[model samples]
Structures are given as structure tokens and as C-alpha cells.
Target chain A: MRRHTFTRFAEALPAAVLAACSGPQSPLDAGSDEAAGIAILSWVMFAAAGLILVAVLALAAAAARAPAEQPRWATREGWVVAAGLVFPIVMLSALLAWGLSITGGGGGASSPPAAFRIAVAGEQWWWRVTYLGPDGSALFSTANELRLPIGQRVEVDLTSADVIHSFWVPGLAGKLDMIPGHVNTLPLVAGRAGTWRGQCAEYCGGAHALMAFTVTALPAPDFERWMAAQAAPAAEPDNAEGRRGRALFLASGCGACHAVRGTPASGTIGPDLTHVGGRPTIGAGLLPTQRGTLAAWIVDPGHLKPEVRMPPFPVFRGEDLRALAAWLESLR
Target chain B: MRRTLVILGLLVALGAVGALLFAWSGLYNVAASVPHWPPTRWLIEFGLENSVETHARGIEVPPLDDPALVHAGLGHYEGACQPCHGAPGQPPNPLVRRMLPEPPYLPGQELRWSPAQLFWIVRHGLKYTGMPAWVAEHRDDEIWAMVAALLRLPELDDAGYRRLLASGARMPAGESARLLAAVGPAGEALVACARCHGLTGAGGGAGAFPALAGQSREYLMASLKAYALGTRASGFMQPVAGALDDEQMGRLADHYAAMPTPPVRPAPNAATERGRAIAERGLPERGIPACVTCHGGNALARNRLFPRLDGQHAFYLAQQLRLFAVGTRGGTAFAELMQATTHGLDEAEIRAVAAYYAARGRPR
Candidate 1:
């Protein structure tokens, strides 16, 4: 009984490890149709490979156990005809056909046209996401996070600002390279409403390891609401402290690199802060969106994410720091 | 075996004699104009790399993520290190470039060393290299600050570096206007004060210098006198303070004391609360009086000799408190009281109370 229990535990160990491997970010979890198809194909290939391994092992065992004399049926010529040439030809042909069918182009002919489109520009260490309206004009701009409507085909136009970066959201679709001066298109449809993590797979520069974002798939109406809110300018400060914060924000030279709509801070060098308060994370997902974190990030972004372009603001102290944080948090 | 041993011993003795003779001969070139041979250069560099790596292996780095550290490091770098090592936009002096084994440009050099390695190099500079050890060895915190700034050097361009260096000396508009107007005839003399102690008395050197804002007028005057009379032994302050006459000293003291106190943000630590507790309610068990009884917390009238601690830098405050605990920092009449009060407090208690006072603000 003890031996049986031990054997059962040993069998379950691999399953436990496999379970731990498939997190919200794992491609094998397959939250979308494209990812599911890829996962299914991967499983099929793994099983076929396992079968091939078992057959080869059995043949090797048989050969090892054979007596001094070889059987007539197991001649060298016969082994070459069956194992060396014919078996490989048949197995390879089947795998090629199966792969072509699964990943064949124009497979989405029966699906409806894409509901919306997003253009993602990859920079040194951050993502610049822009939602495109029907007329090809930008509807809204956000950074480090992408939002999508569930069960809707969305076309993502990928490009680069500085160097080549790959946008890979494993739970949704395959990786696509964002090449400089050229736009690559990727169509994705998430079947469920959930939050998935995406990462820049390319080795960009100093902060490449920290270049990650989140993709939140919501119901159509909820996505619409989020888009509408993101389109508007940041709300005005409602209190004296917030007003002081706004003044400090402009006077402290923060306007040189960042943009805030309806304000004089129109520099396009850094991320847009129009609706920054609504985002769940800041500093390229390095920290959670909270008052203390926001203040800390403003004080020293390079410390949190080393080699970031933003300089530390040691001049801000006491009520000034608090006010700045309050004004940013009130943007939503 | 006996023959082989004898041969080996003779060889060792001959080698030592040859080395001593070579040293005495003075035939080896030691001119700065002459570069080391490739092998010799490689040996020195190899030794330096291994030494730094081994020494840095066990160094536990403190939290260098603070922006304050970076800002202070930039100021120190511009003042001292920039002459030898070039900044992002500014090049090193031409004379320094001609030095043997020229100092490498530091903009992208931080990528090669880990934080601990950088700390070790800064703390204990390499031999035969012009890199000198930190002047103040006890200030490891300042070394870490420079390391933090070095790590961020790659991200900044010329304009960005200039901006960062400029940010350290900036004063509020109102304070600047007021100070500029007050410099009637002693223009250069008055302006010199703003160089280290900012126009608003906020202190440009971070914790390297003390903030003069919100200090009691009497304390300022008395301290200046102590510096002038050679009672205070600061090499940096003594010369400047000694140069001033009675009228100039009094006017400067009154001017800084009257200025609005700059705000000092409290560090996010458990010590802040513990500090506030001790500052408000005295640790009676330890025979310490509540700090507010004399320092003036709410609206209480304070003694002029007792310096105002509100809005002072936590680092400066902690340093002073420690000095008082050790009975070294002397002041006006009530200095003994501070020494006695601090004698019963531990390091943590002193730090907490200092932080509490540093974060406190004077009533309008």
C-alpha cells in the first residue's frame, strides 16, 4: 500500500509542475481561439514524438536481448527499407499536412470583419498604444497596457520607434515583430474576458527585462466605456492641494517630456498622462497604481526601473509631493 | 632527490638576488609620457579587476533607490569628480585627458560593474590609478549615492544631465526675489551664502550641509561667532565666517532665520512614528523629557537659544543628535541640557526623534 501511494505521488508530481507552469501569462492556457489551436497542435506533436520514442526504445531493447544469431526477418536490408526511409517519409508527410492546415492563411474567411484596430509602437523600453477610429485618425493613446473587446477580431498594427521589438501575448496569439519603419499586422480575438500579460521578447536595451504590459479583455460595452473615458482630458483639481500640485507639475519642468491634454504640458517625449490614474500599473508595470507608488515613481523612476529616461525629482518635498500624487490619482 | 633540492634552493636565491639588483639598477622607465607595454598593462588591469570583484563580493548594498541620493550625488560629482571624469555633456579638462591611464568617460561605464563593485571601487580606489578614495571614509551613504547616479548616467543626454545638475541649486521664485533685493552693498558677500545654503536656506548640498532656514536668530548669531572665534573647527566654514564683520554676520544671520522654512518629507519607515511618539510623549522610563517641552511643537513660545528643528533635513538632525549623545556638539547656554537629555537615549530613539522633528512644520 505504501509503495502504491509513493508511486501515485510520483505520477502526480509532473502534473503539479505542469499546472504551476500555466499562469495567466502562459501560452498553453489558451484563452483565445488562435492560442487554443496552437496549443492543440503542440499536444498532437508531443504525443506523436512520444510514440516514436517508445518504438525506438523497444527496438533497441529487442536488439540488445537478441542471441548470437540474427533472425532471417531482421535482416539489415529489411531494417533499412522500413525504419530508415519509408517510416520517416510517411510520418514527416503527415506532420507537414497537419501543420499547414492548422496555420494556413485566410483561415478566418467565415469570421466577421475586425471590429476595431490598434497601432502599437515599440520604443526602447515601453509600448505606445493608439486606438484608431474609422477614418484612420487616432481616437486615444495609452501606454504599457492594451485593452480589447472579447470575441471581437482586432487588428494590431505593430511598428517600432527606435529598435526592433517583438509583441508577444502568449495567452492570446503568437509573437509578431515590430520592425522599424515598417508596420506588421496581427489579428487577435480573445474568447474570454480576463487579464493577460504581454512582454517584449526582443533584447532591446538596458531595461528590456522590465518591458512588459497587460492586456485586459472585457465585454464589448465595458470596453467601449473604457475607451470613451480614455478619450477625454484629465479632470481639473477639485481642492487647493491639487491646484498647488498642478502648478508644481508645470513649474517643476515635468512638461518638457510628458503630455497632459488641456494643459500646457504637450511634450511628446514620454507617456501620455491624460487618463493615467485609471491604469492599474505605472512605470511599465513595475509598480501597482497607488498614491505612495505614484509619488515614489515621480521622485525616482530610474531607481524603480533602472536606466529609465525620467530624471529623479529631489526638489519636491512634504506637501508638494503629496499634492502631486493627489492630482495624478484624481485624473480618472 | 638531494641534488634536485639543492638546485631548486639555488634557483630561488638567485631569483631574489636578480630582483633586488633590478630594483637598484634604476634601468626601468618610469616616465608618464611612456606607455606601459601590453603585457604590463594587462597584468595591472587583471589584478585590479580581480581585487575589486573579490572585495565587493560580500558587500550588502543599502537601499540606493532614493531620488534624494541621486540628486546629492550629482552635485558632488559636478563639484569634485567632474574635473577628472567627464560628465554626460561636459568633457573633462584637457590636462586630465593627458594623465597616464586616462580616466574613462563614465556615461556608459556603469553597465560593466555591479552596484557592490562600484561601491568598492569608490570606497577603496585602485593603486597606480588616479582614482582616489572617498575623502570622508565614514560616509558610505554618500558613496552609494554616487553609485546610484552613475547607474543612471547612460539614460541621460547632455541636456538632461545639465538639467539634473541645475535642479540641485534651484530656489523658489519668491525666496530668490527677496534674497536678490536684500543684497544692497554686500552683493558678492551675500550672494556667497546662497551658494551652499540656498536662497531659501533649504541647503543645496543635501545632507552634506545643514539647512539654515527656521533656525532661531540667536542660535545663528552665536554659531557664526563661534566659527569666527575659532571655537568651531570646520575648515570649510571657518574661513568664510571669519571674513565677515559683526554687522555683516548679524545681518546674514537675521536674514536666514527670518526666511520661511523649507519642507522636509519624512522617510517611509517605522522610525518616523517612533520618532513622533518620543518627540511628543517623553520616554519617562528612560528619564528623557518630551522634546516639545523646549523645542516648541504647537503654539508654545520657545527660547531663542534653543534652535528650531522644524523642517530640518533628517540626516542633519540625526547627525546632530548623535553628536549630542556623545557630548561633542557644543552650542549656547542650554547645550548641556541637550547633552543630558540625549545621554539616556539609544541610537534608534535619537534617530526617531530627529526624523519626527525634521518632518514637523512651524505654524504660520
Candidate 2:
């Protein structure tokens, strides 16, 4: 039963991966390595469940065979009750110990050192991620998706924007709730290389079903390079289109809902877009990053994403929109 | 034993009968038109208010760093919020005024909450007051930052509010206003966005402020237009965009898109780089689209309403996309594209994308 569903899920993934390769680099190869441990853990759990099912069936059969001659208060009935109480306790205690060990319990070992700390605040529908600088200073901040290297240990400081939002990545770790005001901590490590899937485990609201994210694992050096890039100061464009695009960004009022690095558009009602060109996806990887799609979204944002905070730019299309897209793309 | 059982049965039957009679006789008025009796209204209000307070009690609040959280929140306040909650420089929208429990003027009556409480109100939203929960999860930082910013409302005047918006404020002299303008001979055009985003692009807004130092550029640019066009769908963005033009928008997007992402990050135990690769490239096998196609790829000729994402906040990005995918994304005119793009993705994709984008750096 497990094999059937597992194979089906696995097969569909590769197909989808092949279809998404429109960029210079991808994490396909790296994904397998990262997901190995997580996959193993999941499979192991499934196997354990299967074993339990078999055992229960066997026990049921035995009970049926022996209970035919029992009276209401027979000595055999007392034995069954005692077995139920003692056996479950013993088994559960062992399982608990095993589970704790896997999660890095006891004095035998300490948690992996935290390479970095991210404070994630769960809002009604979105996620707020704040990066901590080496010195514990507040550094980079943004929303949705949390990125990390394959081997590093990260301390995720989780909180909620409103109601309860549970953060969970089926392949990496268990679920943790982000409650309003209070911060919860979750320790996560990507075992190998690969992208792991996750979602809001708690019911937050209308957008709860759509709240999702990916954890990408990469080589150490590559991750380091990424960190350096994330730390660099804002760069100004050196071309006319870029200049026009910059102006358009502010005047068009993109600043009201978003924040860009080093600009008058310092509003924080939405995502921080200090490096739009650097990313490969938008709407958290929901839409293909394309000029037409971007243009369509801009011309009428409400049509693309309903009930969102940022408004539409009615005065975009053709050259103007093209110029804007060009300038934004050239940023990287 | 029989008599006791009979009595118990009779009590149960009576309870059931009472409930059925209540239902059949229309004992409770469900009409929104008439206000509930004072006792019922108070009971409900108390239940909702207290429940939220009790449940939210355990939240751990990090100390706020910047004093400008509200200062930055001003732009959003003027642009979207003022329409619903009357502010120093503006009055409530006539349409919003008609809402059943018309949103109050935050500066006057709604300022009683702590920043966290305000954040909860904004992020989680009220039950029947037409208040909507935050469009996305993990966006509490932005909302809380706004709440922190709102703390100053009582002391602000129309002019003060406008000033906070950078209204009439020009970038440092000699700074180039546009990317092309900022280059060569643009020594003067190099205005430091750090004044707001800070030296490292880590935003200067207090606790709830967004970090612009390290965000995805494409999402940034797109977000800007979404606000301007009222597509991203924020109640606060329209008026903000009302005063600005396209050129300024593009320039801002460019500057931020070019900034380096922050160096300090959350403890790196998270498997974000794998997600990063997806953001930098695409998960072809999963049918996940590349971020650059619209945000930074060659497919587009230039920037439009989209803001730059070089140093944006990760929490904010993840939250917005979730909003879009679930039909809750709000801002300006171009939010529709986000909806279309997000419609097919499952929760896994959104999380992956958020993590990938969160760990990204300035694009090359």
C-alpha cells in the first residue's frame, strides 16, 4: 500500500521538475541529497505504522479465538485488561525514548550550533521572516519562504501575526505553531540536498490553504556566496530604462505596500523587494516569471490576485511596461 | 436506579425540547440590521475580545530596535489605511464609512492597544467588523511595525504625517533619480537609500518594519505596481500611489532591486538554499515557474510597476504570495497576475518559494 502511493508521488515530482527549468541554475540534483534523510524518516514512520497494523490484526485474531468461552467476569478478561494497560505503557515509553533520541534529546549531544537565526512571524495568511546579523543585530527582513544551506543549523524564531499558524515541512521536521505575540523556536536542518515542501499547519484564514513555502539546500560555499550577496548595499541602475523603471516604481506608488532597499518607498505593508531581479519566482513561486504575466498582473493586479494589499498600475503596457520590466530584470 | 435514570432522561429531554423550541419559535434574531440587546452584544464582544487576549497572551515580543517603525508605516497609512481609518491628513472613505461596524479612526479610538495587540488586530482581523486577517502568514512583522508606527498617531498632524511619507522630501542632492541617471556622471545621483533601508538594507522601521536589505527584485517591482494599481489590494496603497508617477516608481524599484541583501540571516539550520536554487532558477520537475521570467529575466524589457527585490524582507514576500495564491493578496492594480500565477501552486510550492526568496542575495 505504501509503495503504491510513494511511487506515484515520486514519479509526479520528476515530471514537474523537468517542466520548470527555465533558468540558469536549478536545485533538482541538490534536492535529492537534502531530502534523503527526511524521506527516510517518513518511510520509517510509515513502516512502523504498517507493523503496528499487522500486530493489531494478529492480536485481534487471537482474542477472537480465545474469548469464545469467557464469561462476563472471567479471569481471562482480567488478563486482557492488564495486558492492555501494561503493554501499551511499555511500548509507548520505548517509542517516546526513541523519538526523543531522533530529535536530539538527552545529555549525550547538544543541538547543532546555530549558523543563523531567523525570526518568522506568522500573519493571517503570509509569513514574516527577519534575518539576524552575525552580531545578533536585526538585519534582513522579508516575507514568505525561508532559505538556508543544506548542512547549517538554523534557529527559527516563530511568532504569529494574528491567529495560530503552524509551520511544518513534511520532509524536514514536524509542525510548530506561530501564536500571536509569543515566539516559538524550531530547530531545523536540511540533511542533504534538495527542496523540501511546507505549509501553514494551523488554520489561519482565507489564505491559509494557499500559505506554502520551500526550503532549498545548497553547498556550503554557495550558501556563503548567497549570504554575501544578501548583505550587499543597494545598487543603482546605470541605464535609462532602469532609471525610468525606478521612477515608475515610486510614482506608481509601489512604495505604499512594499519596501525597496535605499529608496523613499519605505513602506512595509507588503513584501520587501530590494532585489526583485535576483529571485526566480514571484507570488511565492505560484506564477511563472514572465513579462506578459508580470504585465498582466500590473495592468490589473486584482484580476490576478484577489484581496491582496497592493493595488494595480493602470498606466502600464507596451513600451512603458516593457521598460519597467527591463529595468527590474537588469537589476541583478 | 430506575427513578434516577428516568429523571436524568427527563432533564436531557427538556434540554432538547428547549433548544428545538428556541429554533422553531425564532427566539434568536439573526438579523444584522437590528443591534443585539446590550447584554448579548456585550457578552459576544467580551467573549471575542477576551478569547483573543487570552490566547495571544503567551506571545513573546522581541524588543523593538528602530524608532522609525511608525515613520515608515506612514506611507502605508496614508496610502491604504487612511481610507478606512481616518487619520491626521485624511478622512474615512464614504464607502468604508458604510461598513456595518465602520472602522474607527485609529489615531483617536483604536490606539488603545499595544503594538502587539494592534498587530494581532490587523493580522488576525475581527470576526464581524469587516476586518480581514492579514493576507498572508508570517507578515506580522510588517503589521506590527505598522502598529508601532501608529503609536505616534496621536502626536502627528497632517504635515507631520505627510513628512513621514517622504512627501516633498527629495533624495540627497547629486543623487541620480533613475538607474541610468545614477550611473556615470551620476555621482550626484547616488542618493543613499540607507537613510531609510539602512546601510545594509536592513530596514530602519522598528519591530514591524520590513527589511529591504535582502529581498527578491522581481517580486519587489511587481509589488510596487500591485500597490499603485490597487491590484495587490491593500486598503492603504491607492492614496499613496495617487500622488506618485511611474518614473519615480521605477527608480525606487531599481534602487532597491540593486541593493545587496542583508548578510546576517536566521540560524542556517534551515534547508533554505535548496529553496534558493528554486528562486534563482526553477523546479522544472515540479512545474514550478522561474522567478526571473517576470521579475528579472530577459523576457521583460524593463521595469514597470514592479519594485526591485534585491533587499526586500522575506517574511513579507512569502506572506504576499500566500495572499495572492489564496485570493487574499492586496495592493494595487496588478495583483490579478499574482492570482493567476498562484492559483495552481500547492502549499509546498509557496513555502519553498518563500524560503528560496528569503535566503536570496542581490542578483548578479
Candidate with best DockQ: 2
lDDT tens per residue, model 1, B90-168: 7667888778898887874547889999988887787888898765454566678788878777788888877666532
Candidate 2 lDDT over A70-174, as tens digits, reads 645445667677667887788779877766655554113465578889888776456667789878786876656567887677888898756899987666566
User: What DockQ would you assign to candidate 1?
Assistant: 0.00
DockQ for each model? 0.00, 0.04
Best by lDDT: 1
Task: State, as a TM-score between 0 and 1, how close model 2 is to the true structure.
Answer: 0.42
Provide the lowest-lDDT 10-residue window in model 2 chain A: A22-31
Clash count for each candidate, listed in order shown: 1, 257
Looking at model 1, give its docking quality level.
incorrect
CAPRI verdict (incorrect, acceptable, medium, high) for model 2: incorrect
Residue pairs in collision within model 1 = B275-B352
RMSD of 2: 20.7
lDDT of 1 by residue, A123-201 (tens): 8688889999988899878899999999999999999987899999999999999998899999989899999989999
